[model samples]
Target: MAFFPSLNLVARRLGMYRSGGKGAWLFLPTSSLARSRPGRLRPFHAAFSTSAGAQHSEEENIDHESSLGRAGISAFKRAVLARHSTKAFDAKREIADETLAAILALTLRCPTSFNVQPYTVTIVQSEDMKQKLAACMLGPNSARVLQAPVTAVFAADLDPVQLVPRVQSLERRKRGLPEAYLATLPFSVAFLAGKGHLAHAFKDLFTTAMSPLQPMPSVSTLEAWSYKNTAIAASWYMLSCSVHGLDTCPMEGFDGRRIMHELHIPASRYAIPLVVSTGFAMPLPSSSPERNEEAKKSPRFPPEAVVFKDQYGHAYKGISQL
Candidate 1:
């Protein structure tokens, strides 16, 4: 019997028992895939069929090895980080759907303030939608977004922290996290998430469906809040992709109002945060030795220079100096 690397990866790496904790199958490593170029292999799954009589510890041993082989447990992450965005993508070939989905899944898992993940993402696949987004692409990015196989928009809800009380209301119930955890933090989360919603939806939700007597924050505050929060989420998405191996172009040069009008997204309900162009890079002049020699060899601060001891001015005189 033949097995695909993806399936083999899952089969061998997973616990035979379906509910065996981490043994459970989770498809699409979004962060990893987002970092991947279009043609690059997105090994989302690995197959490992367990021995019917194998001991549990042996299974653990296998998992340990699997971790080590994750992208070869590579030491080249820094090199990947130094890579710049490509202005061109080979759009003739399409990025696999699963791969794209995986990329998005990472956004879902991305850290949010108090874990209040409040971002709306739209994937532009149709030619017309891509056309609509073209103006959103900046200078060199404009050409790339038009030619790329897929363009994704990352939009966030502001004041997402407003949703914290509700989140705590729900989260505290699960695993019994005390409702007090919310207060211990410097800021309120439910307030943020709720604020995000208000920024994005309150005006419309009130005008179209409210009691007609409800008070609300001014339109400008809500708008500003939504734009601010969504941009943060979008930035996180970009950095996460950057560390993994994907190239992302964060575009702000387009007409947000036109995008809202064309996409049918109510201006009151959502604001366009960023149009991210994803795929393999088309090799930059910067990648060449002549262009990058200086940047690549740029000096890095000594560990001691940055790592300050307990006090701000306390210099580390020696080891255990931490």
Candidate 2:
């Protein structure tokens, strides 16, 4: 079976478990999928499975290579510091096809709960589609949507339970997990799904109604989990774009229902978290005082204010302490 190198690394890093000389599975509750292009949904199960039974120790593993090099890390930090919710873009500039591919590949490497990978990116590349998306966004954001070379709608799958079983099994087998370990997954999933009424209903229908013998997994707050996981992927996408000399603006001020309709996403199956506009950035105005202020860097809280050590209230000290 052909596995994505990133997926393999993620599977390893995220606790790929094995027992009884079986398969190795990356244990995550969420199922993430990759879409090479718009309107195409491919199952990641095959791509995530492997025939090799070789077990890897966390320290000695060579498959776990960093996608971001020293230069990439520097670029990432600069991007994080420099990135803004850009409202203006160089509409004349277009992202190269290879660059976009590289960005998506990196984006899929983001971790998810249970390794379920439960989201899809709908790429809007054409001007007509961008205009349609703009109609659903706020007046101010509409221009940015249209001006960017691409607008990616990050949507979460409401019914990812359907895809979990195959992925779980394949990933587990690849990791050489035993049947005893695999048996516990059903109950774990059911317990998670049980947390939320909507999630419980959707997941229970499959685990119980479809197969009364199995345990169900539902989340207490399904939408929250979905949004959070998808956002991680979105962040990765934006940073990856930054590393490729591109820009992005993550927008939430849009009509979700209208976006669903425009994008042909069925309301029953998917939920839109936000739309991200991607392209080259236009230079901030230098002469205008108001525009200059807009160009000023935003302040951030110090590390001591946000970083905790052992306990919640304990502030983390400098690296010298380590």
TM, every model: 0.52, 0.69
Question: How much lDDT does each candidate structure score?
Answer: 0.52, 0.67
Q: How accurate is candidate 1 locally (lDDT)?
A: 0.52
Please give, for residues 223-244, the per-residue lDDT of candidate 1 as tens digits.
4545665676676566555555
Predicted candidate 2 versus true structure: per-residue lDDT over 138-195, tens digit per residue: 8778999989999999998776566568766876777655443344344343445334
What TM-score does structure 1 among the candidates reach? 0.52
Which ten contiguous residues of candidate 1 have the minimum total lDDT? 44-53
Q: lDDT (0-100) at residue 214 of candidate 2? A: 24
